[model samples]
Target chain A: MQEKVHVSGGTALSEQDVHSGEIFMTEDSLDCAFAWDTGVAINRYLTELKNGRIIATECRHCNRIMLPPRLFCELCFKPSSGWVYINDTGVVNTFSICHVHWDASRIKEGEKPYLPAVIEIDGASAGMGIMQLLGEVEPEKIKFGMKVKAVWKPENERTGSITDIKYFKPI
Target chain B: MAILERITRNIDNRFWDPGSEAFPVKNRYTAGMAGQRFFKEIKENGKIFGSKCQSCKITYVPARIYCERCFERLEEWVDVGTEGTIYSFTVVYKTKSGKPKESPSIIVAVKIADGLLIHRLNGCSVEDIQIGMPVKAEFKPKAERRGGIEDIKYFKPL
Candidate 1:
């Protein structure tokens, strides 16, 4: 049976039997709020993923495709004309050894020791990358320029999420 | 278009009723590994330590995992002397709930021997914590450490 682990505070856990929801406040509480309307973009991105197609906004002017797709073409100085479907294969760019887990609920349930990485898709031009978890490689073995591929969740289980791509592993 | 109109009308209404009810909010926060270690040390040693950037030879008080200047990972730990000079300060008369309190709180930005730290100034009148004033980091009882900035308690004039 595949076991799920909860990670929080950059710490790892043995199992996923615990979770917590607690409210905390600090001097910068007001500064943490967001004024964003990411709903439309998030929904569209997920819908494409459900169809087993990796979609990114491609700029016709500059010919660069943006992931976590953008409303505007960053390089061309024009709006994204439409979407571009990409292959699952990519190259691992810069990455980090995340010794600590980030979410409190995951840590409360005892999850620790996972590596997150930024992988640049092959067709993406110049400095474009996606930040996601790196799987199937021990943290020590990860290095620059490693070849990896996206391992997607089952179609039945797919959600319109960055998390829909379960992880990337060495080819 | 009607939705846009409603949004504009709501803004106009809020301009007149400053305290008109808004969505209720719940507090939430996340601490990084470096932050966790910093607070853990405060709870144990009553002293503060900062991570020094080996590349730029700069130090970050309340230690950070990455150097803000160079964007390099900082791994060296260094102890900052308790005493430092106040860079700036403010006296806050309102509480977290935006209500007035009997005793005002004094907040200060302190430049330690290595880097800058922002915390409260306690054990003195609000007038005592001044710009360029020499002060030292002081801690409260072990039980008072709650994994927050309050861990330091405040800086006192030396």
Candidate 2:
């Protein structure tokens, strides 16, 4: 979100005002709270994650398989034919080293930076991938087209979230 | 393509949470320089202050760093008195939701100190409020103050 300058006009306060925690400073939060509908596709996908599996959709008309499956085939312009279990093993399509968090806060020194990438699952059609994180690999060792496999959490500990598969590691 | 005909019968409330699904994003706000002093004065000292623009010679409230009109750097802090005359007012009888308020509220734009502060007026009924009537700010108790606009509870007729 873009920031608007109030009448304080940027130069109004001193650094002490922030650090001092004196008379003026107040701590609070604005909640952008709302319920999200994960829909038929993601709901089933997340449910499968809890069971230590990956689900995909097959478009019978085009024979294209999609990971993180969707109910409708954008290409075929119709509902997908059926569900298909995808191999959690896949090849890293592309990757990047993230130095900052979503809030742009610096990733502190000594903490490993996150490795974010898209992995093209084995059973999904070519070029179809799920964006996820990489683990158990050094920064310099990761490469494009590297064979990787999802590391699932203990079955009982799994939640219906993408984090159910802790991270993808080089196979 | 109806993926699975068997799954269709039980799809009604399968994924939707009526209200439990809240994605909470946290945020913080910092009162800038001019605002810091303004809120601090009321919270710590229970006094209202404003900054003076030497170029325009106008003492503006909610102390500003730069003059809006002349763009002059305002450095002089003035003790803008809390007491001011009622410049104008409105008797609001409805809540934000368009429902009748439990009691009619008197909101006033008071010409106080060097500038004007718009706040709710208390200790009087709507008929007792009038233009040019003197009013003074009643600040919140020190410990409960958080250095925001709420520092001043409301202005009341003196």
For candidate 2, write residues A1-171 as lDDT tens digits.
999867753445567756766725556665444456677788788899999999999998999998779888898788888899989999999999999977789999998999999999999999998899999999999999999999999999997888899999998
lDDT of 1 by residue, A98-147 (tens): 55544332333344457788888766665688888889888888889898
lDDT, residue B156, model 1: 87
Candidate 2 stretches with Cα past 4 Å from truth are: A1-17, A20-26, A31-34, A60-63, A74-78, A97-113, B2-135, B140-153
Error of 1 at A66 (Å): 35
Calculate DockQ per candidate and list them. Answer: 0.05, 0.30
lDDT of 2 by residue, B101-128 (tens): 9999999998855577889999998877
Which parts of model 1 have CA positions greater than 4 angstroms off? A1-171, B1-27, B95-100
RMSD in angstroms, all models?
A: 16.2, 7.6
Candidate 2: docking tier: acceptable
Residue A136 shift from truth in candidate 2, angstroms: 3.7
Top candidate (TM-score): 2
Model 1, CA-based lDDT: 0.71
